[model samples]
Target: MIGAVIGDVTGSSYEFDNNTEDYDLDLFREGTTFTDDTVCTIAVADAILHHKSYESALLEWCGRYPGRGYGGRFQMWLTSAVHRPYGSYGNGSAMRVSPVGWAFEDLEITLAEAERTALPTHNHPEGIKGAQVVAEAIYRLWRGEWDKIQELLISSYGVDYERQLPGVGVFDETCQGCVPLSLLILTKSTDFEDSIRSAIHYGGDSDTLAAIVGSMAEAYFGVPDTLAERALSYLPQDMREIYEEFRDRFIPTSSLEV
Candidate 1:
């Protein structure tokens, strides 16, 4: 989704060195580039669009984008001829699952699809759960259940959005740490850009966190036209084409209006 891509590009520069809570901070810097988050997200959308196997599509895309700063286990999987689940519980599962939320009409189907997508690599229970929770959140947001969004996340995933955690700049990669924070950021956001800024403000694997937040925020508030165009400019032409086609097929045009 464009939301995930925009978040990935925006947060790429802040992954290390500088982490801030300043919402007015520059979103895109000179060295910013799409990472594994955007690559895998596009892979998921490609798989769904072409009716191909998730594993195969993921493997192909990972192969195509070898230097996209993938996580260790995922990097290994990309190179290995043997494709097997590594039982990882990293937030990678959740980061790449936004497409599942959009591809299905029903919540149950979206959750199931998310689980299936994660199982090929992140077969750990926590990984699957993380993907399912994010996918379900996006699905619910798309369904326009904004009023009960916090209640739904709390009751469903036991995520305590109100609990105070470490301050921004503490890096955490575990699904438990990042997913909840990403959701909480979304809860506090005022718009699509704010959602990404809020997530990045939390630091620690910022791109993945913002990608997760941005995906849900896109469903809830829709992407701003200027923001979307700026984000698209960072993507390759092929990716931009896929994104356009995917959005045309799945998201209604009215939902994209600012």
Candidate 2:
């Protein structure tokens, strides 16, 4: 979960930037901070930790943190009293789904919970699939089944791993536009930080892409202490508490790396 937060913070400054050509860019600086991605991820973790409904948690968290770059439709959903799914197929579902991967041990349960997380706002088929695939990928990596992710994507989602990346600055917010690219970046990353850098280098919807890929990378390559500590510093006290609690409850001791 911290991995996802780290990715969000690191990529926050370059969401739609098309001029950056340096993959070795400084990760954090002025203007770098957590966005809706981190808030929603923490909301998901809070829901799992406290046994609250996903919708309720999302409402509370999003209400607490307004104007954090929420998509137009989601922002409308936040203010409206309807409190229902909006049939969105945006990457928002995928960006906020890392907790589903960490909190469940069973693949079926994980997939089911992933669906539940998406259903509140992203009930469209592509939206649900985006959340499921990202959660499943992380869960599989958590279980040491990283080798199977490509096969799962190919067989189930028909993702062509060899497809070319979207051009820099080409923004596509839909699930179908970003999820496959995130998985492809994960496949090519050498470590946690590399996965983040790769996502930012690819450019479009940087924070969301990195959040999705970073969660999977965290399952595969535990975040470095420096990066983890730096990332945590960007979060507020409440978010940090939830992150620490989730880390204690679901994160495995064996995955820690020096």
Candidate 3:
């Protein structure tokens, strides 16, 4: 998705040593490239192309990507070439989750796919829950159900969301900790840049966190025509095509403000 790509590209520079508050399009322009976040998600997308079932899909995805910065348990599965579940709640789920929200037409189907897709790597409750929240939120936001989405986020996650988010640090990458916060990041913004700034302002797990936030934000915010054109110019032909296609696919059917 463009959200993840733009975030990944935009936030790539700050990955090594920077606070979330330091945000700018200049950062994105400075040598951004796709990392494991996009690669593994590509594998996930690849797997889905092969089969509809989660087990089969993940197995295929694992084979294709073969472990690029995968977590402990996932690495084991990749190297061993076997199906396994770690029951983790890592932020990796959130970064790769945009597809689940965009791929299915039905909300329940989207959430179902989210849970199903999550099971192989993050079968734990927190993991599944995190993916479900992101996929579902994007669905509603795309449908112009802003208030419903906002209500669901507050009721399901916690109160003082805006306040709680900035406190969650870069090390707080767990699904239980990061996903709702990621939701808050997407909810708090008015546009693509502001959405990304919200992630940086929150100041934790920033690049990946921002990537997750950035991808979904782009989905709803609908990148500015000029920015999108310039950003596209920076990408390679193949990836640029993929980005453009995904932008259309993930773009919400309705326009709404969060």
Tell me, by lDDT, which candidate is best: 2
Each prediction's TM-score versus the true structure? 0.95, 0.96, 0.80
| Candidate 2 clash pair list | none
Please report the TM-score between candidate 1 and the true structure. Answer: 0.95
Off by over 4 Å in 3: 19-21, 29-31, 48-68, 160-169, 225-258
Candidate 2 residue-wise lDDT at 140:
89
After aligning candidate 3 to the native by TM-score, how far in Å is the CA of 188 from where it should be?
1.9
**Span of 10 residues, lowest total lDDT, candidate 3:** 249-258
Query: How far in Å is the alpha carbon of 146 misplaced in model 2?
Result: 1.7
Off by over 4 Å in 1: 159-166
Model 1 lDDT tens row, 1-258: 778998998989898845465768788877888999999999999999999898998988888878988988888888887988999998899999998888899888888899998989999998998898889888888788887778766875575544534457877787777777787788888988889888887787888888988988998899999888888888888888888889999987766857
User: Per-residue lDDT for 1-258 in model 3, tens only?
Assistant: 566666665555556545444444354546565565665555445444444565565555455554444567766765665567778888777777777777788988988888877887788887888888877877776666767767877776677655544364556768767777777777778888788766755565666777788767766776665545554555556445544455465545342123
C-alpha lDDT of residue 49 in model 1: 95
lDDT tens digits, residue span 93-204, model 2: 9999999998997999999999999999999999999999999998889888988988867765575544534666678798877888888888899989999999998888
Each prediction's Cα lDDT score?
A: 0.85, 0.89, 0.66
